[model samples]
Target: MRLDASAGGPSGAGLPARLVWLCVALAAGVAAIALGTATWALAQSPGPAPTTVGLALVCAAVASIAITAGAAACVHRLARAHVRTKASASAGQPVAGQQVEVYVGLARRLQGLVHREIQLLDVLEAQVEDPDLLKGLFQVDHLATRIRRYAENLAVVGGAVPRRQWSRPLPLVEVLRSAIAEVEQYARVRVVPPVEGTVRGHAGADVVHLLAELVENATAFAPPHTEVTVRARRVALGVAVEVDDRGLGMPHPEQDRVNALLADPGRVDVGDLLRDGRIGAWVVSALARRHGITVKLQSNVYGGLQAVVILPTPLLGDRPPARPPATEPGRMPSRGEPTGTATASSSMAGASPSPVGARHHPPAPPALTRAASPATAPAFRDAVASGQAPRDAGAAGPLLPRRTRQAHLAAPLTRGGPGPVNQPAGDHDPTLMADFLRGASSGSGEPPAVRAVPRH
Candidate 1:
């Protein structure tokens, strides 16, 4: 198969340049020898040998310059080829800009699919009131969120802007909570109190994406079940968010290398990231760069790596307008609110609003435990701790499952008619509605009893 010349693969272009340089070096060597001999002959004649020798010497100097230039060019070409060969070997594939485009395109397609999947899940969650089934849906929802993050990472690394944009600035704390919601081990993450600030609407999505990557990395690398704390504080440049874990810290040298990469991600080699499985680092770097944010890694008092992300003043914004209550005047807002507005859901659930990584939804009903199996035990535990469920084999299929809209069609049929089948229904309580309406009329619309039900 022919390799692409631009991909740093073996190419005839390099060969020609090297060959040309080698030929030039050889010719220069010959010319230098001939000039030296001529100079020697002029010196032997002893007839104004200085002038003759000077002319020969100048010619030899020119030839020497050619020899040096040619040799240097040949060596440089050889070195580049060697580096490319090693990189290809390490990555197990050619590292090229085209491959990056391919990945970016794939990521974009996956993003669309995942977005649709989340929408479908939102519909199912609204229709189904079975606590166990709802648990499964939440798990699927969280997983889809994680997948979306991965896709965003690829897009960002490929220089793709986030498609989702917020019309208004979001509270920095709300953004942090949304980020925690995207990680697999969100249960283990904690947020310090009083996260005060807001990110500009234009940069809000990218900032959230960047923080999610950092939080995800912290959660994954930290010891299982250990706490990963995320906190934000005012800084001279802007606001600095710190994600600190308690796992074994990296060596100073390794930490320095990572800090350097995060500081100037452009210097990173894609092949090295592929070889080392450091795509998360690259994603964080890319997002940070887009908004002029600064990211760094350092050892913390907890004896683990602390990732500090500094959002510059430009990306920061004044506090946004107060979020509306989950319950509108006469009706309730559907649970299908975009992930960016999840704070409204959180506030309605009576979850503490101070901590950024605090719970967004109420705890799952006990019925979720019934779907537990040896295979899903870990996910179940994570779900319980996080007030969310992990994907269950019994509840949903491998890749985001599409719940059949006409599920009744699957029921066995008898001679008279189909067997009785249970139908999904929204979690609604007539009494709760009456009370909510009464409170709304009285202009004191307190949360109602139905708030006990989890709404994602």
Candidate 2:
């Protein structure tokens, strides 16, 4: 496990022998000084015989040992003081980081509230169809998205997860446009033909944020009269998103620093953010590192910036045919684009109706309890007759929870269904469930009362 294993072996064994010689030289220096002092004392003595000279020599040796020990002690003390100073200086950094942490916590809390509001807005957008209202909601959504982005920067730097997930793979083009939408000058930006594909759900957030940062830099630094262009290409290792601008490119040193950070963003410390002039770059680098992505910044031919982001194969999903758009530089999809998905049944031709649909209708599940008209009652009747359990317990896959499948079956049937089933402890008899559905579906057994309780 040790790379220096050979350093302790035969080859390197004597490499440290010079240390022994150095110690010997130190000892000789001490002895020589002692001898000199002994000679001086012998010369100064009034009457020095052999015994007195020998006694002087002994005193000199003692003095030399004391002096050598004192020197070693002083060396150790100086070393200890230097170490303490360095440690103290390093300790102060965490105190400053703690202050930043307070703000980071506050920022994340605020982000959570804003994110909740964003979720509500998403629900509203889905439920409402009025164009005027949609436009206002759309703008509000954009504003919230920006707020969330800044919040995410704080959270990520503070070492926290941002908003909730996108739940499923998102259209790659849509995610790219969403990133562009957050830019200040989105209108001037153009997206060339992109590889029609989808991005994995969890990676969607990072990819979007990363692209947004690059696109923001492109549009923000570019000349006001020029447009920023986004392009994509399929590469051998992965897919690359390229943002091109005609603005002044970065100086060599800054580009190198940015590239270094992007190459290994773990080297970035949150405490160092204050000294950084480019928080956008920091965020991009950190997020890219988080997602195992590679981002490279290159100077374009026209002395502009080109940021190429390479995403690995795992992040890509359901890649359709590689085709360029008929219209180059296509704008983001407008509000007129349909929000709904077309189902196979909806697309089928020559559909004839029975009670609910064609002569053949899939039997309703056994769990539904909703009241039905006499014509529709037959489906429920068939359901009672069939008494079928869910075929694939988790047929919904990752989209919906297993418990929600029961709601998809039983709860929606009743006019005033037992809203959410508050099941009692240890009873899951399928027959009991079916009976309960039937009871809830049917009107009360008592006859209707004819009297009006109150006349205003």
Give residue 310's lDDT in candidate 1 (0 to 100): 88
Question: What range of 10 consecutive residues in model 1 has the weakest lDDT sum?
Answer: 1-10
Q: What TM-score, to 2 decimals, does candidate 2 have?
A: 0.47
Q: Across residues 311-403, which tens digit of lDDT does each residue of candidate 2 receive?
A: 764465422212222133232111111112122221121021211221122233222211222222332233234331121112111222124
Residue 179, candidate 2: Cα error in Å is 0.6
Against the hidden reference, what TM-scores do the models get? 0.50, 0.47
How accurate locally is residue 366 in candidate 2, as Cα lDDT from 0 to 100?
24
